[model samples]
Every structure is written in C-alpha cells, then in structure tokens.
Target: MQKILLFTLILFGIDSIFAVTHFLQYVYSGSSGIPNLPEFMTVGLVDGEPFTYYDSNIRREVPRQEWVTKAVDDDYWDRNTQVSMDTEPVFKNNREIAKQCFNQTGGIHTVQWMYGCEWEDETGATGALHQFGYDGSDFIALDFKTMTYVAPVMQAFPTKQKWDSDRARMDYLKSYFTQECIEWLKKYVSYGKSTLERTVHPEVSLLQKDPSSPVTCHATGFFPKGIVVTWQKDGVDIHSDVWVGETLPNGDGTFQIASKLTVKPQDWKTNSYSCVVQHKSLQDDIAVLLEEKNIKRTNQGGVSWGIIVGFVAAALALVAVVTGVVLWRRSRTGYGKAGTSDTDSENSSQQQPKA
Candidate 1:
C-alpha cells in the first residue's frame, strides 16, 4: 500500500513540473516600468522559448543559463527611423509614396516605417521609416528617413515558408509595439492588411462544348492562414458548384490555399468570372474574362468598307499617274530624242531646206 502511494505522488510531481514548465515557457509581460530596473522592459517567449527584453531606453536580451546582458546602443535605435502615428497624415503620405513606388516599379507587398507620434524620445523629432515592396517575386525595402534604397530581399523559402515567416514577424511586431511604444501604431500601420496580399494562379480547361455546359476555373496561391475564397459572376456572389481545397502550411511558415468553381458557359461568356479573397486586414478580388462568341459592335453604321476601298483606289491612281510622269521624263533626253531614229538623209534635207 505504501509503495502504491509513493508511485502516485511521483506521478503527480512530474505532472506539476510539466505544467509549470509550459506556463513559464509561454508567459508574456509588458508594462511601463519594472522594479529595480532603470528602464521599462517588454518580456515574452518565442515559440515557447524565452528571449531578451525590448524597451525604449534599454534593448537587451537575457542569456540562457548565464547571467549576461546583451545590450543594444541608443544610437542604434534611431528616432528618425520610426514611422508616423498621425493616422491620416501617415496614411496619406504612405499612399502617395506607395503609389509612386508601385508606378515606378510594379507593385508593393509591404511598407514599414517609424511612427512620429510614437517616438520613444520626448523630442518627437526623429524615427525610422522603412518600406517594403515586391515585384511579383523579389522583395524590396526603402528607408524613407534616409531616402536610401536597399537591395531586393529574395524570398529564400517557398511561398508557404515565406508567408509563415512574415506572419511570425507581424505577430512579434504587434506585441513589441503594444508593449514598448507609448502609443500603439498597429491601428495605422496596415500590417495585417499587407500580410493578406496574395497572388493566385488559376487554370481553366473546357470540359464540354455544349452551350449549357459549365466552365470551371481553378486557383492556387500562398495566403495567410484562415483566408476565405469565393467565386463571383459579374458583381454578384456565386454559390454553385464550388470546391475549396484544404490549406497546407509551407515548411518555413506560410500557407497555400486552392479553390475551384464551375458556371454556365453562356453566363461566363457574358459576365466576368472572379475570385474574391478576404482576410482580417485586407480584401481583394481577381478576375478573368470568359470568351464570348457573340459580341455587340459599338460603332454600328459609322464607317463602311466601301468608303475605305474607294479611298485606297483613288490613292493608287494618283501614285500610278505620278509614276508615269517620272518614266516619261526619264525617257526623253535633253535633245528631245528618245529611241527615235533620225535618218542622215532626213537631217540633211531639213538643214538644206532651212538654208
């Protein structure tokens, strides 16, 4: 009986240790100040592992199994390197910059900057400004404060991996801002919306030739987890013959989502086919046109083919007349003799008659 009790106690002790470990591994705390510390600290765990504390005055990481401090210099935290907190002004400026950048390049995927209102220092004069944009494949960064451009940050991992990494970064940034900054910039940054931008590749193959036969389109893209995909005809939502595939996570961190839909060929021909994707922060719709056999001509009776033919004929005649005049001029020499044989007898008679 005593042996059984001892074994039970040992099991309970092991369970308690595991519970405590799990709690400590995932614990997070953020505040204005910490006791016995000169500067405030924002502490958190990364994937159940403890890391360093981040704050305005002191940015340092706690060493594992050692009493060492990894300190970050104040100069390294450039106040001008930050984004602006004035939502309207920042958004307005950002939109303009984004449009210019997109026009110069093609499109942008991400934009980052330090907030003016959320400046760590009381001066509110400086903050870091970073912008990230993409041209379909490669990622690019721009520093607004320095007006400097960085080289493209190539996506090293597959689409899924890239998405996951971005998600982690966004999550970390949100937590960091909420804890460290006096004013939360997450509401204005559009980080959630930017992360939701995705490109879907869809292929459609004709299944049947009948007018009533349904035409289908398939799409696949790397998107954030929990995104919703829907099919639309023209501007209206569609619910017929839709198939949504399972979203798979990429090894690095992102996810791949696929979906398919079928609609009447006639409807597809007359209306636009679209895929609308939705996420917590962003919403976008992509569409493809369905080929139409019958289309109305806009210019009904304005111009006729006969008029064009007549104009061309007149132009050709004018060219022919000009060509004939050129040939005639070339054929006649300065003496006005062109292949006309002037017999010696005739020439002599003419000369004598004239005398």
Candidate 2:
C-alpha cells in the first residue's frame, strides 16, 4: 500500500511527501478567443509554489519570489526572457496546429504543454514529464520507457510521427530532462532553501455548518505541504462517512487540508469522537474532540470571526492555485479522446524515446 501510494504521488507530480521530493514544473498555456486573459502564458513552479511567471501580456520572464530576485543575476533573467520569447511563437503555432487537427475553426480553444523534472532528495532518484494537451485534453506524451511518443488521440498521430522521426530531438529531450533539468532544480532548491526547507506547524479547526452537518477538521497555515487528517471513533480510525479535501495553498505560502466526518448527535454524545491530525513538524498528533464547545458553528451566535476568515482564506487560496495552473483540461467538454491515455501520472522510466 505504501509503494502504491508512493507510485500514485510520483505519477501526479504532487509534492505532498514533506521535503523528500521536490518538483520543477513549467506549464505553458496558449489560448484563442479568451478575452481579458493572456493569449500565451507560462508559469514555473517549484514544489507547487510558483517562483517565476511569463505571459504574452508581460512579454518578459519575471521573478515571483523575493528569493528568486535575489539569488539569480540579471543574465539569468535575460536568458530566460529570451528563451521564453523564442518559445512563445512555437506555442502559438502549436495551438493553431492543435486546433486544426481537432477540426476547430473558431470559438474558444486551448493548447497546454506541461513539462518538468522531479528530484528525490533522499534517494538521489529523478523523473521527468513532457506532455501536450489540445483543448485541455491529453493529446500526446513522451513515454520514457518505450522511448516513444504516445498519442492519446487520432489527431495527434501526425505529431507523434513527426516527433518520432526526429531521433536527435528525442535524445536532446532525454539529456536535457535528466541532466540539465536536475542541475537547475538543485540550484533553485539551494537558492530558496531558507524558504522552501522551513517547516511550519498547521493550525487546526473543527467546524460545523448546522446541527446535522458533518464536522470538518481543517488544518491551515502549514508548510512543506504534507499532512494527514483522520476521523477517530472511540479511538479507532473511521474511513466511511468521511470526505477528505485536497491539500491547498495559503496566501502566506503555507498549506491547508480538511476532512469531514458524518455522525449523529446521539452517537457523538455517547462515544468519544475526535479529529486527528498528523504532520511531520508535530511531536504528537493533534486530536480535537468532537464536541459542541470545541466546534465553530456557523449557525450559532457569538461565532469566532477568525474561523470564518480562515475559511474564506482557504477559498481564495484554492482560486490562486487554480489560476496559477489554469486547469483548463478538466473544464473542457465534448473533446473526443483518441488513443488510450495513460492514467498514470509520471512515466517512470528514464530512457530516451526510441525511433
């Protein structure tokens, strides 16, 4: 089960395992017919925290973090800006090519390219991803194990063939991802070590909307982005009647998570129920008892404003993460799938794509 969970995490490129694994992702999005938004945009995230941003509107690669501004020299920004400028046209062209392949003449459309490398600090292991999506759906991805591009749709066949014929490009991608990307990732991690490596304990809250609503165990303002929230009934773990929330980012760069457990008032009154939180920074798990006095009830009078503010902050943080990544794929509709898309997150092999 541990191995399975680890594999799942590697596949999704989630930095949820404390500080053992660090990721460097560059998500490029090009869209048409979208008003009040950049036609082309690229964001660089280190451990799910955006450190650099580049959009067609800005026309420049800018640092998003103070540490990034201090750690890198002017040449660094100039080189990246030039590289982004050079890559902008390619993405625009790709977007059109993708649209044409999908028989899309007009209306809103998007082409997304997310590529990145991940490094395991403890094991000295690494992984990489290079995938493209048309209208926010999987189009093609380079399978490192087969050393070939896997097309998830018929429209992507031409792209696969073109890229497959270019053995030199495949080799370059392999070398760049495994060697150059890792070196840069290490440098960036080192540059932002003080900010990235530091751990902050989570602030937990038990909340309820009404008398019959399920209780929510919310932990916010935590760092390292790793935590576990569980429900305990009479000291045993309760799995059913529970809904676990995604680990979300806070405005202050910390992280938050929530778990909801359903139970009747009579049951909780007779049995001891608690919300247990486990984090790396804590010496002991925090167990907040399920009681009326312990919970922040929204329907009740004299409610703590802090709890309401924190809940609002979580909502805003979710928006920030969504906009930062611009998860256009999930929002897409009626996009026909082509090839059998690999549901697995990361392509585990490190080999170059074969011709």
Candidate 3:
C-alpha cells in the first residue's frame, strides 16, 4: 500500500507562475482505547487550510476559519453538524468491524476514511480520491476505472466485496468526488480568496548562537509553504555542510524554515558567504550576507536579546516538535495520505491535490 504523502498538495503564493490547483478534503477518524482524545473526529480542509472540524466531544460541526463562519449561515452549520453526527456512528462501526477483521481484542486501534476532490481552474482538470485505512495501512480504496472497490489486505476483501455490490453507495461516492466535492471546493475558495490567494514574503534572519556553532539562516512568515533556503559561497550554491530544515507552519498560517551552514570562522571571512531565499512571493531571490555585523547576535550584555530570543525560539521549536509528533502518531494509526486510484485521465486520481 502506498503511504499518503502529507505534503503532496502544494499551495502556491500569489506570484506563482504556474496555474493554481485547489483542493477540498475531508478526513474522518475513529479510534478505540485512546485516552484524552475524542472517539471520532472529522476535519475538512480547503487548500490545506482546515475550514471546519467536528469531534465526538464537541458533537457539533464548527468552522475553523473565520471566512467559513462568515460565508455560511446557521442552517449550513446545523446541516453539516447533523451529517457529522450521523458519520460518527458509521466511523465507530467501521472501527469495530476493522478490529474483528484483524482478529484483535485491541489495545489501541484506529479506522480512518479520507475523501476529497481537486480542480485546476486553468486546465479544467479534476481529480478525486476516497480511501479507508485500518491501523495506519491501506484497507480499501475506490477504483475509478473498475467502478469498484479494491482491498489491499485480505482482511479488507470482505469490505471490498460488500461495497462493490452496493450500487447506491458506489454511485453516491462517484458523484460526491467529481461533482459535489468540487462545487463545495469552489465555494470555499471564493469565500477565502483574500486569505488564500495572497502572498507574504519571508522575513529573513541570520542567527548564530555562538561563533563555534553553525550559522543558521532563518526565514519566517512566508505564505503558501513552497520555499527554498540555500547556502552560497562566492556567488555559487554550496551544497555540503548545509542542513536545511523542513518547512513548518507558523501560528498565523504562514511558514518558516532554517538552513544551517557549518563553516569555520576563518573560512567565511576569507570567502564571501551568504544565505539565499527563493519563493513565489519574491521577484528575485533575497540574499543575506554571512557577515558578523548582519548576524542576529545571541551574545548580548546582561539580560539582553539572547535571553529573550533564545527563550522564544525554544518555545516555538518545542511547540512545533510536539505538534509534529502528535500528527505523526495519528498518521501511523490512520490519517495518512489518500490512496491512489486507477483512472483514465492523468489528473483524475491523484492522492492529494495541490491548492
């Protein structure tokens, strides 16, 4: 079974050259024997930004984005809430069925259903996916070509057979992916245009904890996630001795990354060194020289910049780490990438859509 690549849907900034691709996705998860978490949870995302959420504990479908709340009325929420309420039992039943199929008495287990659609405005191209997972692995998925369900594991074959035989369910899924899902995606995009379509360039900072430690080029507050941070030596890209961190989400829906270069103090002094940032938001790459004066010093006098920044950076890093761990754990138990389906069109069965 192919693992869902969580970062496959790449949302572009405003200055992008390529045409934008939008995504609408809903993930439903049900878990057993997990503590301090809702038994069933649902998340709806548009262009990778969560717009709505529902959990057993809340028992209500709530809008996560301000625009979502503004765009839809109380009736909309009420209707979706009912839908989610109905879905909760189905997810619970799925979990129980999955446990039995696996022959597990169960310590902790999860069942997940992820379904969504993607549309490319420029090309009139569309794609869709619907998949079910059992214990972090692919259980069954919809096959567009066969117009039937596929089982990845023997334990899931029964489900595939049953679902394939259910003509009503199959037709509903087909319509949901290609039609209903795309309509909803377009509506959400229209509602969140300003927030989703705009771009914010990164704030570049050269940070160094100490002279002996590697110098880090930090770029924060960029929108749309796609970015490149690299080290340059004497006007040339330097690949070795450089560690580029993963792009991480900021609290305000932007992104940040850090690229560290290991070099001797003498080496950088003798040869010109710089950190370069490339993004759709910028017309040209922004380069910050690796110079002592430009460095954001962490060695200030008594009770200074070092203490404050060190504390804040540490806190932010801790939060990112914890959040990543939680998401990773959830993905391991379910909540992974959408399963790839067989289809005629190249864009018809993507695992996840870029928005």
Candidate 4:
C-alpha cells in the first residue's frame, strides 16, 4: 500500500506562511551606573540561542571568545574584527539611546530593536516591521511602523511638518541599521532551511458522527509546504463535507496540516473512503482507504461484520485455489510454483487508473 502523506479537516486554523520566520533583534541591558554595557542580537528566536552578533561601547564588555574560536579556524578572525571592532561603536550609541529610553520608561528593561519580514496565511500573508521594545514593559523605542517614537525622548517633540521631515530622515537612517543584523538574518535562515527532514505522511482515522463518522486526515512533518489532502467516498470526490487546514511549522522547520470530511454511516458500511494526499515530492497521491472489511462490530456505527465475513470466505477460497495449483505444478515438474499461478489470481487484480 502507498503511504499516507497528510491529515484531516476539522479546522485547526494554523497560521500559514508564504515565507518562514525571519527576525533581527538588537538588545541592551544596563544597570543604574555603568559606563560600559553588554551587547547582543539574535535571529529567529529572541536570545533563545547564542548571540548571532555582538558589539559593546567599552572593549572590556566584550565576551571572551576563546571557547568559541577554539573549534573554528583562523578565518574566523575576519568576522570577529568586523563585529567587535568596525561595528562596535554603532550599537554603542544605540545602546545609550536604548538605555535612556529604558530609564525614561521607569523599569529595569532591555531594549529590543527588531527588524525583519514574515508571512502568515491568516490575518495577513506577508509583512515586515522594524521597532524598538522594552524587555519587561509595554513601550516602544523607535516606532518604525509609524515612523515615530512611542515614549518621550531626550529631544523634544516636533511640529507636524517637522515630524514628517524628521521621519523621512529616520527612514533613510534605518536602511543602514542592519550593521550586522541583516547578514546574520540571512545566515540564520540558511542554516534553518538546510536542516530539512521529511515526516511520515498523516494518519487518517474515523469517529462515527451519529449518522456519519467525520474522517480526519493529518499530514505532518513535510517541508517546502505544498501538500493537498482531500477526501473521497466510493471513489468519487467529496466537497460539501470536506475542510483543509493551514500549514504550520513543526519547530524542526518541517510542516503539518489537516483535512477532514463527514461521511455517512451507510456509505461507510459498503464504500471505500480514501483520504488522498498529493505532494510534488511524491510520485503519486498516497491513498488510505477505510474499508468495510476492516471495520468491526456490524452494529457498532462504522462496523461492517457482513463484509468482513465475506472477505474472509473469499480469502479462504483463494488460498485453497493457490494451494491446489502449487500441488499440481509440483507433481508435474517436481517443483512448486513459487508465485501465484492459479486462475483466481486474475480475479484479484485491480484496475489501474489511466494517466
């Protein structure tokens, strides 16, 4: 049997994306009296992983690199110089501005300067945002979305016309804010995308829905996102009762989704209910058929004991035919037929679909 590649349609409502998550965060943490402060930035996850890039106003604030570079070669020196030396003071000024913003906000907070693009199937599909945030508080540093500052700054507020003019200047400056964030963002996404893995196609199971059992099809652990999971009853397509969910990340970077249909109890009894999945990676759609013979308990909603018994009787007859044919062949040639050679074998073949 072909393997199942996807899942059911009960409306899981997972957010879908045309692109994966891409993010850059520049953060600053400081005490009441400190001339030099720590520096950090990350991609994808916040500070969940190691710092993708770093810089500090004072050289002493830089983290020791011996442990990190021991495994790396001499070529790593170039990157070290770029992040810690050439670009160090840029974030230093940003750090001071961020620290000022944090103190103004009246809390012990780290400033999160984020710049990135993202896409989701729900709400909206594609978007990008650049903003400043306080770690534990709810205030913005530089509100890039509106091109304004969310909290009061050292500089006084401007007139309407002056605000627009300053905003235009701010826009020009942000084009260069990456310093190292954008490059790091690219490296982060590249590494994430490279670690791809394929999952076993979704499993489809049934629950009798009073007069019918809603068949749920789950297609999980696939990558590059385009997989179609649909329901078919008695070899015919179903629509009115079918639903398909959005593709969601599996954290491992692979994706999963579900599709479902409510099938009638009568149809469930005598017909083939197959959840067919199609993906470009696969040569053909994998079909998982809910068969009557496999259903137990004649009266247990989905059970079809009559058909199960019929299959048993047919199976026994076919076995007898094959045994007799093997015996006759052995008697004549002194060797049994190694495979099916009886007339009943012809009846067991199924009609293949035309291309």
Candidate 5:
C-alpha cells in the first residue's frame, strides 16, 4: 500500500511539471492571439489554455472577421491608408486630385493650366496648362472626373521648400512669368508670339561736388517683345530726352533691353524719379535713388606740413651740435699752447734772478 501511494504521488508530480512547461511555452510564443499577453505565460496557460486554444480554432474558422477586426483596431494601417490616398493622384497622372484636395481642405481658390508647345509636340498632346486664381494662387491640371491631380515634379517657378510663404512664392511666380515664362511661351505658343514684349528703364546717380553732380542711370528687363520704357518724376512723366540702348538677347532666348536717361543735379533732390516698365504681362517701375558719389581725400588740410617741419628741425639741431664740438676743440688747443709759453717764461726769469 505504501509503495502504491508513493508511486502515484511521483506520477502526479511528473504530470504537473510537464503540464507547466508546455503551458509556459505556449504563452511565451503568443499562440493565444490575444492583444495583451500575461506576465507569466505558465500561469496564463494553466488558467487560459482552454480559452486560447478555442480562440485559435475560431480565428482559423473566420479569417475574414479576423482581418476586419485587425484593420479596425490597427492605427498604423489607418495612417498608411490616408497617406496612400493622398499621394495616389500625383502618381497616377490624375488631375482630379487637386480638385479633391481643394474641396476637402477648402484651401485652394483657383486652378489654371497653361499649355506648353514643346510638351504638346513631344507627346502629341496639348501643352501643359498654367492655372491661376483670384486668391493669387494657382494649380495645374486636375481631372475632376477621375479625382486626380497631376503636376510637373520640376517646375520653372521656385518650389515651396525655397520660399517661406505663399505670398513669396506668388511674387517669384510673377517675376518668372515676366522674365522667363513669357519668352518661352512666345517661342512655343502661337498666341504668345504677338503678345510678349521686353522693356528697359534708366536711372541717375549723383556725383559729390560743391553740391553734387548728376550721373546717368540705366537698367534693363526682359518682356515679351514690344514693351515700353518711360521716366517719371514725382509720378509725373519726365519729358526729358531719353536714349534707348540696344536690346540684346539673353542666352536663354530672352531679350536684354537697356535705356539711358540724363538727370540734372537740381533734379536729383527736388524730384523723385523712377524708370517705369510696361509689358503685356508686367507693369512695374524700379526707383533709382540718386546717390552722391563723393571723392574721398586721404590727404586733407596741412597735416603733412607739421611732419615736414619736424623732420627739418631735427636735421638742423644735429648740424648745430657738430659745429659746437669743433669750436670747443680749437679753443682747448689755443689755451694749452698759451699756458706752456707762460710756464717757460717764468722758469727763465726765476733762473736769471738767482744768478
């Protein structure tokens, strides 16, 4: 009876140990598929084995449910989906993306597409469309039907990374439109050939004098083709003579136009002058401040005279010292000879007296 009891106890201990080890391994391996696992897999397996084992069978039976539950609970999946949707239109060459983004965000006001001839010719399609809006903003091609937005990866205008604000970006766009785009448009687009023009404006600089002298000012800007240049004084047109400088072509196929206007000294301060440029796409003026060109004199007043006098005085003092030394030596010689003669005469007289 003792042997049988002891043997039964040993078997029970062995079975418990094996069961604990298996439970721990299962819990540690996350075979339960629960969102949160227990701290001690052995304890959880001992208590949760039936539940976890049953869940695994259920998951295998209803795979679709498992997928749906995972999708609903996973934050990472949602974020990735949003990003994928946002970038889909750009990569798919769909223009409707812009419209969707605009409508959804209520941020973009307008969209325009300016067509380029080169692109059209190469692709056998219409050129790219340049879009603009009332808010001083613009977008390119957007396909409303397909919900797609497509923009050139690289554009002539400064990109968002290069500018601090939308206003700065717009300003750069306007400048580029006047300087580079218009010329390119004219070359490629049939309609632009007749509408584009280039112009030049001149200014004046002042030279410093009793009051000051006036200098000529010149500036040049590229436009389409037939732009005009004018001078204005205090907002009034200056009727002064204007010289038109030669227009050179910018290597980029744009015109380099120049103008010169002669301004007088009296007109420098009394009137505010500006060089006005007028073009099909741009109407602006550059104000030139008449700056005084004063000559800088390194040697002013009698500052050098003091330096010359000091040098001459030092040389004269040196010569006087040498002359005094020579005179002293001659006097010493004369005194010595006289003293010797007197001594000899005294000795002779004394000897004669003694005789």
Candidate 6:
C-alpha cells in the first residue's frame, strides 16, 4: 500500500505540490497626499502564471496589462530614476525581470520584490525603496534609510577588486532610487488603505466528498481575504473526522474553501448538520443549514467548480491518504499511536497526497 501510494504521488507529480514552488511579489506604493502620486499598486507572480496586479484606488485585482497600459498611457514620466535612464526603460526592465525570475526560480522557496516610494509628511522627507529578495531574506535593498544599496546575498567591496562587478550597477540604482525616484514619489504618488476595506460576501454551499465520504461546506467569493468556515453538528462543534482544506484564492479578487466533516449515518439520515460561514463583510455569522435540497444542489454543481476548486479536491484526497492509511493500519493491527488522528495538522508536506 505504501509503495502504491508513493508511486501515485510521484506519477502525477502530486499536482498540488509540483506547482507553486516559489512565491514572487512586486509592490509599488507611495505615501498618501502627494500632488499626483499613484496609488499603492502591487503585482505578484506565482509559478510564472499570469501576473495579478492590484491598485489601491480600485478594490479588486486586475491583469498585469492594466498596469502596463497605465504605465504606457500616462507616460509615467512622473516616476524618477536616479540614473539617466527614463521611466519607460525601467518599467520595461521590471516587467521582463519578473517574467525571467518566475521562469528561473521554478524550485525555489520564495521571492519578494518591491519598486515603490516611501515618504514622511511631518518630517518632510522622502525616498525611493526599490528592491527584491529571495525567500524571506533580503537579498537586495535600495532604500533611503541608509542612503545606500546593499544586496545581503552579495559581499561589498573591501579590497576594491570587485569595483567593476554588478555592484557598479547597484550603486547607480541606489543613486536613482534615493534621489530621482524619491522626487517622483514625493511629487506624483500617494498611498491609501482602500484595499483593506474592499469586501465581497461569500456564496456558500455543501457538497459530499464522495458518495460515501464526509460532506464539505464550501464557501466562495468572499473578498479582502482571511475567511474561515467550520462545521457543526447538533448545535455543537465536532472536530473528529474533519478536514479543513486550505483557503485558496479565486484568481479574482475573492477567495474560497472547503471544510469537510464526517457525517455518520444517523446525522446524514436525520438532517442535523450545519455549516457556519464567517467573514468581516457579514454582520453576523451566516449559518447554512444542510438539508436534502442543499446536498442535491451540490450534486448538480458537480465537476463544474472542479476547475476552480481542484486544489480543494486534491486537499481532500491528501487528508484521506495521510489519515486513512494510518487508521487502516492501526485498525488492522489493533494498535494506535498517540496523537495519530491529528496527523493532518502535523503533516506540512508541500506535496498533496494522491487519494
């Protein structure tokens, strides 16, 4: 059984784990109340997929082309590069770099990047902070605080032997980000917390994992992220035989999830199950009563949401593999390990187990 499981996991490359090996972000924002400053805009790339661009002025995320179009249409000359290089040149470079980085870092952990301005009103001070990093560590930082550019991943010049290396270009970037870019941010950019306030109410439904498995309370379309869903039985919470799938992005501005709970024969036959959806957008915790009609509706919606909720399905399978196999073995041997049932919370393998 173990060998079969291993082969299955390797055959499909464990679809969920093979993807999203690394994370990359490109964020640009300026302090609020500038003359013509742009909004806090962020573009993120994952596994070299389509870039998701977000602007503070608008609530939802748009395609990267929207940001590119704005950059081209507005001429974006208001952004200053400390070097003689113009805005268009740097903009083009940023776009290409993001694409290349995604393609190259197919197996890395994480990559974070930023190209934006930071300002202080009371101090009447401004600076441009444009840099990117690997994992959670800072590989490069071109910021105003130190008045310098440093790549933590790279060694600085001490012997003066590496003067002609990439450090030369970094020095110039430090110059541009601090002076010219700072001026542009001060003169043309502003920041607001609008995205935090954007919210979308969720649409909830309940579905059976399979013909015989536990039921899943799936919620989608809630926005501003960070929503939680849980299952209740007979006005009380039940954790045994529950699998809370990861909350995944809807690729739009919203998010979705599937939290599954085992329904014994009695509960399914008696109609005593309920799902509670919670989000900041809603005034109160929304309760979804599970009944014959709801389950029928879920049956009707089969495989349609599969495209978007594929990850959740994979997650359910992983939960079963990681738990079911252990339980089966234990039952066969009539011996169970301590804390065995809670392996779902302990297993952090990036790969999703094949059902």
Q: Best by lDDT, which number? A: 2
Whole-model Cα lDDT per candidate? 0.30, 0.67, 0.65, 0.37, 0.27, 0.41
The window of 10 residues in a row where model 6 has the poorest summed lDDT is: 334-343
Give one digit per residue, the lDDT tens place, for model 2 in 73-174.
Answer: 668877777767766666666666656555678887766666777788888877776776666567777776566887866766766776777787778898
lDDT ranking of the models: 2, 3, 6, 4, 1, 5
Q: How many clashes in candidate 6?
A: 7
How far residue 300's Cα lies from its native spot in candidate 5, in Å, is 22
Whole-model lDDT, candidate 4? Answer: 0.37
For residues 78-143, write the lDDT of model 3, one tens digit per residue. Answer: 788887787676666666665665677868777666677777777766777677665656666776
Off by over 4 Å in 1: 1-221, 250-252, 280-283, 289-355
lDDT for predicted candidate 3 compared with the true structure? 0.65
How close is every model to the real structure, measured as TM-score? 0.23, 0.78, 0.69, 0.37, 0.23, 0.42
lDDT of 1 by residue, 113-185 (tens): 1111122122332122122222112222222322333333323122223333444454543444334432322
**Comparing candidate 2 with candidate 3, which one achieves the higher lDDT?**
2
Candidate 2 local accuracy as lDDT?
A: 0.67
For residue 179, model 3's alpha carbon misses the true position, in angstroms, by 1.4
TM-score pick, better of 2 and 4: 2
Tens digit of lDDT per residue, candidate 6, span 1-355? 4323322232221312322111122332212233332323334332112234443345344444233323222323222211112222333333334335435423323222344333343444333334433322343443334434443332211111222244555466566545655553333222212332356788887776455666778888776445667677777876788887655555554567778777765666686778887776788888888775676334455534565555333322121121122122222211111111101111111111100
> Relative to the unseen true structure, what is the C-alpha lDDT of residue 272 in candidate 4, on a scale of 0 to 100?
70
Could you list the CA RMSD of all candidates, in the order they appear? 34.9, 6.4, 7.4, 25.4, 48.9, 17.5
CA error at residue 207 for candidate 5, angstroms: 12
| Deviation in Å, model 6, residue 103 alpha carbon | 18
Q: Output the worst ten-in-a-row residue range by lDDT, candidate 2.
A: 334-343
Which residue ranges in model 5 land beyond 4 Å of their true spot? 1-217, 289-355
